[model samples]
Structure formats: C-alpha cells, structure tokens
Target: MDYKTYKTDDFLFDESFRQWTAGTSPEATAFWEQWLTQNPDRVHVVRQAQELVRALNDHYQDDATDARLTSELRRLVRNAAERREAEAADTPSIPLGQRISPWRWASVAAVIILLGFGLWRYGNVNRRVAAESYTHLTKTAQVSLQETVNTSDHVVNILLSDGSAVTLRPKSRLSYPAQFKATTRVVYLDGEAFFDVVKNPAKPFLIYANQTVTKVLGTTFLVRAFESEKNVIVTVRTGRVSVYTQQDFEKAQQSGLRRIQGVILTPNQQMIYNLGDHQLMKALVEKPAAIMPETVSREQVFEDAPVGKVFATIEQTYGVKLLYNDDDLSACLVNLTFTNESLLERLDVVCQTIGASYEVLDGQIVINSKGCK
Candidate 1:
C-alpha cells in the first residue's frame, strides 16, 4: 500500500496501520515510528489516524468479515435502485436528458450505502455493556447499596455515607454502599458526576466507571463516563487522584493489594481513557484554576521580574510544573501582572514578551527559546 498517499480514513481502513497503532506487532510499530520520524509533516494526519483506529477498534467488533459487509452493501444498493424505479414509474417524467444519469444515480446510491454501513459498523455493542456494568455491580455487591439516578434535567446532589458529596449530572447514575462499613468507600458510576470527597487517608475512595478506575483520598474531581461516549474522562480540580484501567484494578484486588500504582493527576490535570482502545492519556485541563485561590497574592504585579521568577509564581499558584533551563531564561525579564488570567493566557503573554514559545506535554509546560541577548 502507498501509505504516503493515505489520508486519515485510508489509514483507519488499513490493517497494518491498525496493528501499528495498537502496538500489536513489533515490526509494524518500528516501521511506522521510523516512517513518522522521516516524514515529519504527516505527523498530524498520522496521529489523527492512530486515534481513529483505536476508537474504531474499541467501538467495532473485529469479527466482522468483508464478505458479510460486501453482501449487505450490495443488498442495500439493490433495494435502493428498486425503490427509485418504482417512484419513477408513478411520477410524470419531465425529460430524459434532464433526469439524473444512471452512473450519477449509482454514485449517489453508493455514497448513501457507505454512510449507512459506517453507522452499522459503529454499533452500540460496547455501549450496552457499559450501561449494564454498573447495575450488575450494584446488584452483585455483598453489602447493602443505594443507587441515585439523576433523571432530572438538572444536577442532583447526593450525600454519601462518608460525608462526601456528589453532584450527579442528568441521565447519570451513582451507586454507593448504604454505610461505610468496609475499609474503603467504593462507588459505581454509569454517567457523569462531580465529587467532593472528605479527607480519609486510611480509607481511600474508589470510583469505578467503564474501563477506568479512579482512587482518591480526599479531593474534588469530575468523572464523565457516559456509556454512549467513547472516552471516560477524569478531571481533577484539587488534590490528586490515581487513575488505572479496570483490568489492573481487578488484578490488584485478586492479589489482595491495598494500593495500586497508576497515573497520578494533580490539580488542573485531566486523564482521558478511551473505552475502545483502553488508551490512557494525561494532559492539562482545558482551564486551570488556582490551587488555592485565597492564598494567591492580590499584588501579583511584576515589574521587570526575572522570567524564571514569573514562571515560579505561576507554578506556585496553579500547582503545575513549568520546565525550562534556568541558564536559558536567566537573562529574560518580564513586566506583567496576573489577576485572573488563565494559565495558558499568562504563558502566551510571557512567551510573547521573551520571544519564545511554550508547549504542553504530559500535563507539564515546556518553554522553548534561544538565550536572551
């Protein structure tokens, strides 16, 4: 296959590309990585294809055969042609030349057929499983549990037995034990919710949503795991939360381990777990709030402050890491005041002042610049 000419959809339909994206074949992985490194300009298209492949794998069944799909496609075209012929016989014809040609009609029919097949391929097979998993868990639990389903259009508040609070979003469901009698407080969620958990170091709070499991001690976080969605997102507002796959969590449970090491997301960080591919990605949240708003100094006005000092102040206020060479930014100075500007906005102004640029990588900001004159 001429991969150089392949677009995102073309790559998605390729077997070798899918294998490379899933890391199933070592040779494919090496080949694609080297190809990408050599063709740097195609990085965006390749990455987009990789994400789509993962998503398609997670949502579609691989057991589908080309023969079956082809047969279905032919059947659809036949039915569509027959219906068009019947409609034409009942209607009065204006002129043969004015009517659509047979090839054009066939082209339109093919496009419609392809679109319908795409929808069928992206079926709700996994969605059904995710929706039922929460209910199944709650029913099979040994302890007495209470489930609160927010059927209303607005958010519904639920006070857990541990004094923690949950604001469940519409069409979301949360199941928790009637009492915190066990060593840990556990909850099963099928939709979305914002949690404000009380501090309890000895007994950690765990939330199971779709393929991801989140564990926290005492923090506020948001989990959006709608069954219809292809990704399970966990965004931290304050403190930290450990996010891991459900498979790993189950393995730890079977081994009788009290703790499991996973991706640690602090304040202003978010984790997205693709339900289809089981891929976990960590990045900075869309909008980062200050770690402690009250603690932020009102007089944040900086006049000719060292760029490193400005970065330090931003990091302190947001509890985020800013990576840069001290020697490189040592001579760079900034004169700016930040009152309620977002993290990215502040970075934009700083980078503009210093004739530099910034990029967010794995939830940290990396500043790139030549030494100041």
Candidate 2:
C-alpha cells in the first residue's frame, strides 16, 4: 500500500520507529504495537524492514553505527511525513490515533543498510519471512528461483521467501524460490546446509540435493551432498525427515513410493544414500545422546541390574537399535550409575564392565563378546 512513498533507506534510518520496534522506548513501543495491530496489510513490510535492521545491528555492533543510522532515518521519516502532509493539506487531518494505523511508523524504520552488504545474514535461523518486493517483481507465475552461493570460507545464512532459513556451508550453492509454490516448498542444494523449516502441512518442504530428495514438515536437519562425495547424507537433529532417491520419487509418482524405496529418519538418526550403488542405509548419528522425556531423570542409577537391561534402556532413550544378542549377554549383570555422560560414554562403561566391545553397522550397534560366565 503506497510502498513507493518511502524508500528502503527511509525505514532503516527512522530512529523514532526503530526505538519502538526494538523495544528501547516503552511509550513508543506501546503506541506502535497497537498501530501495527490495526494495519495488518503493512505487517509484511514492517517485518522485512525490521529484519534488515536486525541484520545490520547484528553485523555492526558499534554505537557510532546506530547514531549515524538514527540521524539518517530521522531525516528521512520527517521529510517523507512532511511531504505527505503537504500533499494532503486539503483533506481533513486524521486523529492522532488513526494516523498511526495508516502508516505504521513502528515498522517504517527499515532501509538499505545492506545496500551492498549481501543477502540474509541471520545466523542459521530459518526465518521464512515474507520478501514481498522480491517476489512481486517477478514477471512470470512460474517458479521464481533465487540462488545463494557462499563463495566465502565461512557459513552463509539465507532466508527464503517462505520464511525457511538455510545455513549454506562454505563453497555451497543453494537455489530456492523467492516465493514458494502453492503445493510444495522445494529447494536445490549442491553442497551442504542446515535447514530449519517453517511448517506448512499442506505444502511439504523438500530439499533436492545430489542424488537424494529429503522431505520434511517444520523440522531441523542437515544435508551434506558434495559433488565429489560418494554418498549423500541426510541427518535429523530434531523432528522426522523422509529421504528418498530423486529418481525413485519421480518414478513412483503414479502409485507412490514402494516401502523399500524411501527411509524415514527420526531425531539422532541418519539416512545415507550411496551415489554409485543407489543404496540407502539408515543409522544413528556419530555422537548419539539420550533423548529422554523431560519428566524422566537424567541421573538414573542401576544397581545389580542385568547389563542387557542397561543396553535396552540406552536403545529406548536414544531411539537406537542395539544389536547385541540378548541370549549371549543375558547373564552379564552390572551395577553402575549414569549421570551426565553422553550415550557413547555410557556404552563404553557398560561394555567395559561386561568385558565386551561394540561396533556400528548400518546405524545399528553390533556387540562382539563371548557370554559373561
């Protein structure tokens, strides 16, 4: 609504509005907060501008930067408001309360602070904030794609139009929509990334990386699929994720994927697809941890309990499949207490007590031991 009236710089420099949005001034915050509530149409604009300011503040934490920006923003907002008033002199002035609604001064503080800085710099936050201007400028209704290439050595954070956040690893390339398609949120990656997706059940979030197609709904996960690497791996940090071959998903469109074609991974689980053989292997992550409920005490101790029961508890806590033969280890009893040690550490202790060892095979733990006589 009349976005052309204020340039990007105007929003960034407006000190009065920035104070409200930043909650630095209580009086200003209250007035602007109420004003924004009444102006739903302007919410997106305000949010974008706010994101820009936050990005700058995060990058440049100097007090001088804020002062210079505040001065520039003040000048811009004042000049623009004056010009608007002069143009509308003939019209009756709106009440002070009503004036704030039409032009939410609160969100009018974003501008081109990053004029040449670069794109989405928020640290690995999948904001999924609406970039209306970027999306609106596209000519065709076809997929409006935007590529974020992290040529630098450090990780680059990017925000998608659908509000999803992508943390692109160094030397990685990610192509995503400026605005999502109505049915699915799709992104293509050539290297590695950590994604925190915004959930929309109607539209699934899909990542097409290397030879894999990962599907999720509002989850955080990591995908590593370098061009030179032999395997494309998808690891779940939180929430469930489905991994399948791009070829398989495309082929199974008519009748849906066969049960064996895809793998669903829960937290601390990983799905690896070999590029050469196209074989998918599911397993636990390298450093597994106990995923107990909040109510369960983390410092549970075992006294005179069978070692099998201890291993079983580990399996259930971390959602891992411990492959020790129950029959072989049924006689191994142990008395130990597990406190804050990680799952791996706990396992080491248990195995030492029973004089056995373990190895991981395809995400399952295989125990090697003669029966503890």
Candidate 3:
C-alpha cells in the first residue's frame, strides 16, 4: 500500500490527539493504526507528540488528582477490556487477555489524567480572553485637568472619548477631562496643538487658550499661546472655527449692550487677541515666516541696526540664537543683509562687516563689538 500523507491544522490535531489519548474509541484506535502504518519508519514522531501532550497533562493534574484521575482511569480500563473482547472475536488463535502488557496499562492511566488537566487549562484561557474583550468606560463628572508632558520632541497623539484626536506639539501642555460630559468637549491648551475634532452639532468642542476661547462643531486648526506672549493666535487650516472672549458672550447678552461680539473664521483666516486690552483682531492668515521662503527681500536695508533687532531677525528666520555681551556691546549694532546664508555663516559675516567679533558661548552666538566703528 502507498503511504498517505496527512496534513493537519495544529490546533485541531492537538485537540483531537488529547481526546484520543484519554480513551480507546474505535475511531481513535483506527486513526492511530492508519497513521502508524503510513509512516512505519517514523513511529518515534508519534511518540514524541504524545509525550508532549502527556507532560502538559501531568503538570496540571496535581490538583484534584485523587477524584478526577481515579474516575478517568476507571473509564480507560473499561474501554481497554472491551477492545480486547472485540480483538478475540476477529483473531481466534491469539489469546486476547494475554496480549496486554503492564507498560501499556500504565500508559493508558497516564493519558487519562493528562486529558482531564488539559480540558481544565483550556477553560481558563477562554475565560481570560472573554474578560479582556470588554471596553473600559469612565464615569461622567467634572474632572480635574490631566496634564501630559513629552520632554522629547516627538509628537504626542491622543484619542478622546468622543472619537477626536489631539496632537500636541513639542514643549506644549494640554489638559482635558478624563471623560467628556453632556454639555461640551472642553480642553485647555498652553503652547501649541493641532486638533482634528469629531462633529456633533449639539455639543461644541471648546479650546480655552489664555483669555480667548475657540469653538467649533468639527474642524482642523493650530493654536499657539505662549505664557509670556501678549496674544493668543488661532489659525484654521480647514473647516470653520469661532473665536470670542468669555466676556464677549456676557456683553452680547446684556439688554442694553448690543455690539456684535463673536468672530466666525473661515479657512485660511486667523484671530489674534491682545491680552492686555482684551481686544480681538481678525486678519487674513499669512503663513509664518519661518515656514516660508529662506530669502525674503527687503526694499531698503538699515545699516548698523540694533543688536536686539538683529538677534530677533536671526531667531525668526533660521530659528537660531544670538547671545551678546551685555556690558561690552548691548547697544552695538551691525550693518548686514541676511540673504541666503546659513545662520551661523550669516552671523560670521555680520560680525566681520561691523568690525566686531563673536564667539559661541553654549549654543548661543555672543557678539563683542567693544571698540569698532
């Protein structure tokens, strides 16, 4: 007979093997006999697989072995006795009772104990998988702001309960509730963040940045409000957003005070608030210069400009630093056109042009123009 190869799914084969080893069913015995005859040369492969199953059963059968093992052993013995009687009817010359070995009886007892333990462990894993499938829900209430800081420059992404995403920029702080309540989705932002909110017409998403509050049904926008800065800036990249003050709402509702209060922003529009005077100004949004062209031309340039102004220009343009010796050259100025040079190289040319010299102290470039025209 040509040997037939059997390809089996690992899980199905393991489960079937476990059931087969527990007792001698006619189906189980037939399968084992066919498998052995097909690959008689590889009989040890079957033994190794069976041994692994037995070891697992032995490990887990420690608890309740007296009750479970005794019951399982009795079932195995009865099955073996029935198999012997069936064999006697087919082969009259072979003595059925004398065919069994002591070792074969021991193997049957071991297999039954293993099968009981395997079933118990399989039940435990299923229960754990079911328990882990449930989603975590939070109670609704007024919760304190939870602040998360990412010291590294990596962008931090968070998913709100309302299915919105907020990406915080580097060196920024954002605070929101552990769970959103019925009224609105409120978040407090300091520094900068990019928001992609989910739309719910009934409940608006409000971002409180310093004195100004930005409200929207759903929109994508960027907000920057540094602590020392006098203005809170909101730039809308897409969708619509409304900007107004807390006082603006109160004033608009007054019986006698009837000035138009809220500012609705369209795409590519920005709102700036003067923190000192509580004035809100709307302007067509211009891309920030740092993100714009490297070489922005000026019609006319100033010669020997104030050191402070020069440092500010360098910081804004190439996002670099300039340190100055306060006592030596705080009032010193340089004459230069910063057209298309790397930041450090530009600083070098500026120092040379003004007959001044500079040295890098820490990450900042310090200028010392003590005695120069």
For this target, which candidate reaches the highest TM-score against the unseen true structure? 1
Quote model 3's TM-score.
Answer: 0.37
Task: Give each prediction's root-mean-square deviation over alpha carbons.
Answer: 10.0, 20.3, 23.1
Q: Encode model 3's per-residue lDDT on 162-279: one tens digit a residue.
A: 9989898888777788788798898777678889999988898988666567889998888887655788888776678888874554355475665547677755567888765567
Candidate 1 lDDT over 1-373, as tens digits, reads 5677765545645667778987889989999999999889888778866765565455444435645644665576677778888988998976877987654564566556656666776564455454347766778777888888898999999999889999999999998888985589889999999999999999989898886789999999999998679999999988899999876777789999977756899889999998766678999988888887864546578898999999988888898899999999899887898777778988999999999999999988899999688
Candidate 1: C-alpha RMSD after superposition: 10.0
Worst 10 residues of 3 by lDDT: 132-141
List candidate 1 segments past 4 Å from native. 1-132, 256-261, 295-299
Model 2, 213-271: lDDT tens per residue?
Answer: 89998888899987668888898877788998765675676567555368888878899
Give the CA lDDT, 0 to 100, for residue 9 in model 1: 47
TM-score of each: 0.65, 0.52, 0.37
Clashing pairs in 3: none
Model 3, runs deviating above 4 Å: 1-141, 250-260, 288-373
Model 1's alpha-carbon lDDT is 0.81
Which portions of model 2 show Cα errors greater than 4 Å? 1-142, 161-163, 254-260, 289-300, 306-309, 323-333, 354-357, 366-373
**Predictions in order: lDDT:** 0.81, 0.73, 0.62
Better of 2 and 3 by TM-score: 2
